[model samples]
Target: MIVTIDGPAGAGKSSAARSLANRLGFRFLDTGAMYRAVVFAALEQGVELTDADALEQVAAQLRIELGDQSVLVNDQDVTRAIRTQAITSATRYAADHPGIRALLVDQQRAAAAGHECVTEGRDQGSVVFPDAECKVFLTASERTRGERRYHDLIARGEQVTLEEVLEKQRERDERDTTRAVGALIQSSDAVVLNTDGMSPDEVVDRLYEIVQQRRVAK
Candidate 1:
């Protein structure tokens, strides 16, 4: 079984997907981190964000490992480094490029080729894994997601204000929904869950039940 949770950034997709995978004893694939790793590497190499050809070249050569708990790029641990607000804002240069999105989609499918997996990203259901057994389009208000992101960043010892985070979150939402390739949209067959005010455990439990129901139906 492959469960796909698709939503915008700052939504609790990562937290809920990780916890749901643990509960279901399934492998977790963070597709967003794949794009983030590419972005992080691109910025590290000083590749211009507007250079799509340069970005594709970097993605094709770098080694991205998606462990159960961490992300490694070129054999270097970049799990935390890639999640910073800087990379988050600059992620679209890679994600929006058709070539880079195609390359990463290949990697994402290969990673889940023979496993029972729970994958989360902006386009998992609509593009990467359209045939997934259980597809979810998780929704959360922009403000709610911003608060979550702001608190998480503060907890990580990163100094950022709620206003800044929310502003960035809005920009991300606009870009994600309007990107040229792999844009974020709810699949026709996906179950839409508005996650505002939902606890982490509650979210996973709901997803778990949804998956179980799908398993029975399958």
Candidate 2:
């Protein structure tokens, strides 16, 4: 079975998906990290963010490997590097380009083939895996999401204020929902799960139960 978990930043999609995959013995694919890797590579090569053509080229050339908990770009480990604020913001530019998203979508599909996978990203169910057996759209209020992100950055020892984190996440939510290519929206058939007061384990348990129900229905 292929499970898709789609949501905006700090909605617990990544953590839930990873844990869900582990619980079910399925492969976990973090599609966001692929775009982040592209951004990281482009910035490393000094490619201008606004240059869509150059960014698309860089995206096409990237060799990204998604492990259970690590990300590798071009054989170099970037698990922690890509999560920095710099790359996180740069990923918006890379992921917003239509050409870059198209290229990455193809890679994402290829990676899921021949495996029971749990995939998470903004457009996983809407665009990348529309036919997934179980599709979940995780969500939370902006304030809740902002607090989650702020604490996450703090835990990573990044010196950032709550106000800054909130502002950036608000901007990201606007861009993600309004982007022309692969815009983030809840798929019509997806089950929307609010994570405002839910723990990661609770979210995954709910998703796993849904998957079980889906299997029986099938």
Candidate 3:
């Protein structure tokens, strides 16, 4: 069973999906991390963000390992490294590259083969896992999402203003919707969850219920 949780940035998809996977005893596929890993590698190697060829080369040589509690890129633990605000802002370069997205999508499929997993990302349901057993689109108001992102970045010691964060969020939202490939979209079949005032645990519990229902229906 593959359950995909798709949504815009800062909508708590990562936290909710991770918990939901743990609750269902399934592997968690953080697709965003896969892309961020590529960006992190490029940054580490001083490769330009727009250099698609160089990005492809870096991705092809990278051994990105996603474990329950850690993400390793070429034997280096980048779990925290990839989640920084810098990676978040620069991820679009790698994500927008058709070649890099193909490589990462292949890795995502390989990771889920013969295993039940909960995958979360902007484009999972629409692009990466279109045939997933259960598809969910989690969303909140733009300000709510922006505020969440602001706090998260602040907690991570990133020096960013709320206004700046919100501005960047809007830009990212536009890019996500308009990207040429792997565009972020809500699948028509997806169940939408408006998480304005919901707690994180509530979100996960609801997702668990949805996935269990999907399993039974299957």
Please report, in order, the local distance difference test score of every candidate based on alpha carbons.
0.91, 0.90, 0.91
- RMSD to native for every prediction? 0.9, 0.9, 0.9
Better of 1 and 2 by lDDT: 1
Model 1 pairs whose backbones collide: none
Off by over 4 Å in 1: none
Lowest lDDT block of 10, candidate 3: 206-215
* Candidate 2 lDDT by residue in tens digits, 1-218: 89999998989888889999999999999999999999899989999999999989998888999999999999999999999877787689978988888899999999999999999999999999999999999999988988988898888889999899888998898899999998998999999899778877787889999989888988
Q: In model 3, which regions exceed 4 Å deviation?
A: none
Model 2 whole-model lDDT (C-alpha atoms)? 0.90
Q: Which ten residues in a row have the lowest lDDT in candidate 2?
A: 85-94
Model 1, residue 145: displacement in angstroms? 0.6
The per-residue C-alpha lDDT of model 3 at residue 197 equals 93
* lDDT at 11, model 2: 93
Residue lDDT tens for model 3, 59-87: 99999998887899999999989988889
Backbone N/Cα/C clashes per model: 0, 0, 0
Q: How many clashes would you count in candidate 3?
A: 0
The residue pairs found clashing in candidate 2 are none
